[model samples]
Target: MAGIVIVGAGECGTRAAFAARDAGYDGAILLIAGEAGLPYDRTKLTKPIVPGEAPFGGLSALRKPICHANQLDAAGITLLAGTPVGKVNSDARQVTLTDGRVFGYDRLLLAVGATARRLACRGGDRALGFRTIDHAQTVFAKARGKVVIAGAGLIGLELAAVLSGQGAEVTLVEAEALPLSRTVPAGLAERLMARHQAEGVRLLCGSEIEKVTPGFVTLSNGKRLPAPSLIAAIGVVPNTTLGAMAGAMIDNGICVDAQMRTSVPGIYAAGDCANVTLPNGQRVRSETWRCAMAQGIVAGQVMAGQTASYDDPNWLWSDQYDLTVQVVGQVADRPDALRQLPEAELQFSIDSDGALIGVAGIGRAAAMTKDIILAQRLIRAGAKVTARALSDPAIDLKSLLRTQGDV
Candidate 1:
């Protein structure tokens, strides 16, 4: 049977298969993956890998397979693991695997995801790129001494926090003046930087890696640091080769519409491999798990002839040391206005129409959790709220919503 063929059996691909089944499409569903094992949560690779711990370890760990064999069988999902697709023939609706196998598809979903970007400095190969579970394991096994990390983005900072927690001295290098300069507000970034410094993670902002040697890394700022282990969490490049080769439009990622439909009609793209157009005609790709899952589900629903569109605001969270940092919506672009809730350790970005457009918080887990949920609601609804109400911890967000009849 010519079935729905999905490439890249990560969160997006697996979820798309399940979503298609759940939406009542019972035809043959083929899930293809380059990795050997079942689909696991890629987000958990940065977390502390604790062996034998429940939920976070063993089969229940985020690193463990999210989709088991029995589950796949029960769902009637056929999985081809450890097999990479070499090219996609959009016109013929066929996929060619690296091992010379070919599969025809009525509809195709490209969820190939992304790979970590590597640095080009001398001896850069000595530094490992932290993206996969294997990379995490290798770093954990070799993290006995001082470790230097390139880039001060989420991955770099997260690894720093995890390694430092395990008693390894960590140093983070970033060419930007502040860590997460493009994602979080300056105030929140400052707080995070302070938290890392307090926990003994050295920050080398506005510094570049001049050269990397077997035993050390020299900074452009003329500082030489000991580096028993060097890691690069620079960024990621979307895996758009197959889609591009198949004649799908490619920009920052595989360009897709709100329905996750690619330039090619029978083809769709989701997850990290898909770049979605926003309400303002802006094309962007969200590499977060939440965005990927949403896109995949929507793509599946659309493929099943159901009405669906992915319009959720961008959301992502990071657990660094004792702090749980959550950011939602577009805070990178300067908002029309900004408000700070110092007591609550929160910042809200207001658009020109006085709508809550973004929120960033770093504090006690429970409090931040509550604030994040409320912030998401307000941002999603585009609620026009006063800065005073948002800045006051005494005022409950629910009450404000009720007062405005937005609930």
Candidate 2:
């Protein structure tokens, strides 16, 4: 029926199928997946499993689809799993599989997502990446012994927490002077660093590895550490081959408008692989799970002839040990207002026009999530707030949200 055809079966693509149905897209929806079995929730991989429990238990996402089989069946979305797409034939408005099958589409969405970026060092090959379900299975299945993880990013820290809790000696290697230097504020970063150290995690920030041998890693400083296992949590690169082949403008990722529309007609990109062009023409690509799901919904609705845009502020959170870190919008080094709550410390950024621009906080999830969400509403409403007001616990944040008229 040449309905909406979505490529990639991650959260972004899977959600798009449902969003299309909800948006009144009754046409045939085809979701193509590169991995076999049900599409899994990658978040489950970080959880520590009990002894003697099947490794697959940690891979519940791999075993269970985003939606139950019955739900997918009821939606009538055709799922083509475990097939490699040979090419995205834009001119023909078709997708060709490696097995020589073709499917035409009235509209096409590219949610191909990103892959784990590799280490460029000499012994980087000895390290296994932490991205897919198989990678998670291979890693946590036998997470004993000493493991050396490269990169002190969110992924690395989370893995270290899990392994340390499971009784594995872990050493984290990072080239940066501080962990999460790129995204996290110095104040919040310090708090997390102290927590990691308190939990007995060895920090080797501002260091590099000269080389890695079997069961050992030699540092550039000439120190050697036992590394019976190696993991790479460096980062991820956008999977942009298909979109680039289809002639979509590429910057850091496949460029798309706020509506998730690519330069090419009948083609759109979303999720981690989609770079959104702001009104100022700046290209911003978000790698957060929420951003992916939001972009997917926008693409689905827009493709279904509904009105929508990806206007939500970028938000993401990470859990390590007993700590939970959350950031919304774009947090800067210096903030316009700062607030210290009983359970969380928040930094708020306001624009020259007195509109809320960003917010960052680290604390107990119960105390901070609602406020972070409230701050996002403030940002959206262009609400004006005072540092004194933000500092007071008696003043409910929702008060500001309700009082602020859209500027």
Question: Which ranges in model 2 have alpha carbons more than 4 Å from their true place?
Answer: 51-64
lDDT of 1: 0.84
Clashes of each: 0, 2
lDDT of 1 by residue, 1-407 (tens): 68899998888898999999999897899999998888888888887555653222322113768789999999999999998999898888999999999999999999999999888888888888887877877777676568899999998998888777766788999999999997888877888999999999999999989898888999997789998889998989999999888899999999999999999988999999899996579776988888988898998888877899888888888889778778888775344434344433677788778888888777766667777788788887778988888877778888766665645
Instruction: Give the TM-score comparing model 1 with the true structure, all chains together.
Output: 0.93
Model 1 ranges with Cα > 4 A deviation: 51-62, 332-344, 403-407
Clashes of 1: 0
C-alpha lDDT of residue 41 in model 2: 66
**Model 2 lDDT-worst window of ten:** 54-63
Query: Can you list the residue pairs that collide in candidate 1?
Result: none
Q: Go through the candidates in order and give each one's C-alpha lDDT.
A: 0.84, 0.84
